[model samples]
Target: MIVKMLHDAGLRSEHAYLGAAASIGLSLASWLASNRQENLERADRWGIFVGEWAPTFFGLGLALANYERTDGEQLIDSQ
Candidate 1:
């Protein structure tokens, strides 16, 4: 259902994949910034929190790709 909603909303697998990649960079940046501006513990927490989002986005990308493949006919027809 979520995949269908994402597809219907025009969110492709590429977008989700890109988001995952971006999240990784953001996580790194956050870690570095927090480490410099705050403390080691705070930086670790920030990095872990942001790093977790990558997996969810990757999962979403996979799901969307599968949805696109399985429902390609219908999607193309609609378009």
Candidate 2:
């Protein structure tokens, strides 16, 4: 129901959480893939650490779906 909260609060799905999900996933994936190149230092390690945020994004997407009105939040919406 988080998404409904966001929506009721005047936030658009595609503009906020949805966009955040895509952005975080892409960033995390790229960071993870790039980390396999060589010995990464502390900063690079931090990058990899930060790259693991994709699942959180996905979870937020789930919350958004749960907040949906129709059919108890269909997961297969027009994503």
Candidate 3:
């Protein structure tokens, strides 16, 4: 249901996948930037926090893709 609502709102699987990729880059950038200004522990924490988002985004992307596939199958069958 949530996936359908997200799809209806124009949020596709590609967007989620892209977001996951971007999050990984952002995490690396954040780690580098923070390492220059803060302690190593803090930098590691910052990187880890940002890195965690990638998994959620990936999961969403998979769910959306599955939904799209099944939905497409239903549409074809109904015709």
Q: Point to the candidate with the largest TM-score.
A: 3
Candidate that would win on lDDT = 3
Q: For candidate 2, write residues 1-79 as lDDT tens digits.
A: 5566676886543444565566666666666666676555643665656555655556665665555545344655754
Model 3, poorest ten-residue lDDT window? 1-10
lDDT of 1: 0.95
Candidate 1 ranges with C-alpha deviation above 4 Å: 73-79
Candidate 3 deviant stretches above 4 angstroms: none
Tens-digit per-residue lDDT, 1-79, candidate 3: 8999999999999999999999999999999999999999999999999999999999999999999999999999999
lDDT of 3: 0.98
Q: Rank the candidates by lDDT, best first.
A: 3, 1, 2
Better of 2 and 3 by TM-score: 3
lDDT of 2 at 41: 69
Write one digit per residue (lDDT tens) for candidate 1, span 1-79.
8789879999999999999999999999999999999989999999999999999999999999988888987878898
Q: Residue 22's C-alpha lDDT in candidate 2? A: 66
Window of ten residues with lowest summed lDDT in model 2: 66-75
* RMSD to truth, every model: 2.6, 7.3, 0.6
Error of 2 at 31 (Å): 3.4
For every model shown, the clashing-pair count is 0, 1, 0
lDDT of 3 at 69: 99
